[model samples]
Target: MTEQLEKLNRLPLRDDLRGLTPYGAPQLDVPILLNVNENTHGLPQEVQDAITASVQRAVSGLNRYPDREFTELRTRLAGYLGHGLGIENIWAGNGSNEVLQQILQAFGGPGRTAMSFPPTYSMYPLLASGTGTRYVTGDRAADFTLSAESAAEQVRAAAPNIVFLCTPNNPTGTALGLDVVEAVYEAGTASDAIVIVDEAYAEFSHAGTPSALELLPGRERLIVSRTMSKAFALAGARLGYLAAAPEVTDALRLVRLPYHLSAVTQATANAALAHADALLANVEDIKVQRDRIVAELTELGLQPAASDANFVFFGGVEDPKRIWQGLLEAGVLIRDVGIPGHLRVTAGTEAETTAFLTRLRELLGA
Candidate 1:
């Protein structure tokens, strides 16, 4: 490995990317996968049939490049989002990561800056770096929470060209109040910055926790990104999209490769959206497991944060590494997230959840 790495460094790689590692999590073959926060319920049979049929039809058009605009996919996504959005207001890419990368490509670059609060999504910094945008880290409270006031103040201080706000934040599973979004937008106006609300886990948010999509009516500079990967149970399909002002989509077109979204991807996403209700039924079940994890962890005297996404993040572990390893040996895999005394677990099906909880209890001797 050392020799290969040394050889890789011999290439004339870009200076900024010289030592950077790609983003990923462990893909172990375990009986239970509670890591990566995937919707482990698997797709309903009906949605599966729909996607397969859609792709079968799209296969005939493989000889031609896909619709560069991906018009019907955008329309379906807009209808699904439904905040008075139209096709012009929607844009898509391979996944929410690519959607975010495109945003950085369009609005962030050399001499420009992008900021995001930490203990949040890990990808924000990577995307900034990949796009040559200077990455800036903003502070969060010791508890890993960011209040509206603190967020707004941080924006004013950074004066960045772009801002990423990940709600139901990754690695912690805490959702932000829309007031934080509103406040950050107000603060960013000084720099004419583009504010992105990454709602990759929005569909799994606890009831009555409103989405940033509600704030899109007049906030032209604000972008709300969503994905079919989670609640839609289409992670393998890799369809992620955003709702923004029409002009924002136009701006993205300037940087996106021609025919970036393939015909089959558009077809799969359209079919999944067609069955949104069936797929979302699983979301409700996952939420039950998520809440159960939180309640059980609290009962165990551990510190589980208030979760609005499909996962739970908790501390109070005397030995996180030991617990993680014990679970792995028992064929259960969850995320350690590089945080001392803490771990994150996705809420899977009932049996999967039970397996994880059972193994965890044995490890903790609770």
Candidate 2:
């Protein structure tokens, strides 16, 4: 390992890429794996069968390249989103991260800049780095919340070429109000910024939470990105899509590699979309578990943030590392998240949630 590290350092790597650690979470094989914020519930048997059948049908056409445009998948995604969106307004990539990277490639590079609030998604900076875009970090409240006024002010000040808004944000699990999106968009008018609202966990948000999709009609600069990984239990499918103005997608077309999405991937995602209701049934169950985690964690004297995502992030651990290790020893694994006193856990199934909670309680000696 030392030799490899020395050799890597000696190579002529980009100066900006030097000393940057890759983004990853611990991938431990534990009894209750709730670390990565994936849907704990496996796919419904029916959805699984549908995907299998679709893949089988697509197998014969393996020799041919997938439709570079992915027209059918875009249409299906638009119907699923249903904010009066159409195929012209839809674009997709292997995952939301790729969709975001493509955006940076199109709108940010060299002298251009991309900005996002910290303790948000860790990938924004990494993606910016990969695209050779200047990365900027904005501030959030001590409680990890961002207000519309603060966000707008920050956007106006930075005037970045691109802005990333992670709704029901990762790690922290808090959702931004549409007002923040509106404010940031208005503020970015001076820079003509492309604002992206990442809705990876939108399906798990509490009742009546409005989506940024509602704000996309006239906002050609705004993009709302979604993934089939969480709510649809299709993490292996690797399908992420966005809804934006046709012109914005047109901009992406210049940068995206031809036939980037594979035929099997399209089949799997399309089949999942066909069974959206069945696949999303687990979302309600996960929400129940998430709320349970928040309530029970509070009762145990931990300060869990209000979460609209599938995961719960809580502070008040006197020793986060100790608790994390203790939970691991007991065969339950959750994310330590590197925060001083906070840890994040994906809400799992009823039994899995019970396992995590019971182990956590035992660790706390409660």
Candidate 3:
């Protein structure tokens, strides 16, 4: 492996990517799989049947290239969001990551910078690098919270061309308030920054937690990206969409490939949305598991941040990797998110959650 890496390194590679390692969360097979924050619940039979039918209908259309505009899909997404939005205000891609990449391509590059809070999503920096945009990071508070004042301060300091705000932030599982979003937007006006609010876990958030979508009415620079991969239990379908101003979607058109979304993908996503309620039925159940993990972990003397997302981020570990390994040995898998004393675990099925917390409690005692 070393020799192979050495040989590959000898070849010409992008200067920025030279020493970089790929983003990876271990995809290990275990009796209880909860590392990546995916919904452990299986799709409902009704949704599965709908998807099968939709794909079958789309099969005959394969002879022709998929729609370059993907107009109907955009409309369906807008309706799902229900803010008087139209097809003009929506965009779809293979995944939220691709939507984010196209966003950087259009609004960030070369001399421009893309900024985000660290200990959040790992992919934001990578996406910026891939687009030739300089990556900048700000620090979150000790509790993994970012106040509007501090967030606005960073905006002024970085003067970044693009700013990413991940609500119900990855790894931390803390949701940002609209006040923070507005404050950051206010500061960005000085630099004309495009602020992206990644709401991939929106559907999994606790009830009454408002989305950044509410703040979009008059804010043209704001973009709220979401996905069916999590709460909708369609991770295998690979569909992510964004709701932005018509102009933003129009700007993305300049950079996106024609027919970037395939027929199969479009069919699959539309089918899922057709059964949105059923697909989302497990959200509350998952929330129960999420809360249970937090409660039980806290009872065992760990500090778990309050989470609106379907995962919990906890601290106070003497040895995170040891606990992580012990869980693996016990046939469960979780995430060591590179934070010093912290680890994350998705709220899997009830049985899976029971196994994880039970195994973790035993390891702590040992």
Mind giving the per-residue lDDT tens digits that candidate 3 earns over 246-365? 899999999999889999999988888888888777998999999999899899999999999999999999999999999999999999998888999999988999999889989899
Candidate models: Cα lDDT each: 0.92, 0.93, 0.91
Write model 2 residue lDDT over 1-366, tens digit each, in one string: 588788989999999998888999888887889898888898999988999999999999999998889988999999999989999999999988899999999999999999999898889999999989999989999999999999999999999999999999988989999999999999999999999999999999999999999999899999999999999987877989999999999999999999999999999999999999987788999999999999999999999999999999999999999899998998889998888999999999999889888988998994
- TM-score between candidate 2 and the true structure: 0.99
- CA lDDT for candidate 2: 0.93
Off by over 4 Å in 1: none
Q: TM-score of the candidate numbered 3? A: 0.98
Give candidate 3's whole-model lDDT: 0.91
Candidate 2, which segments miss by more than 4 Å at Cα?
none
How does each model score on TM-score?
A: 0.98, 0.99, 0.98
Model 2's number of clashes is 1
Q: Rank order by lDDT, top first?
A: 2, 1, 3
Which stretches in model 3 have alpha-carbon errors above 4 Å? none
Q: Tens digit of lDDT per residue, candidate 1, span 318-350?
A: 999899999999999999998888999999899
- C-alpha RMSD values across all candidates: 1.0, 1.0, 1.0
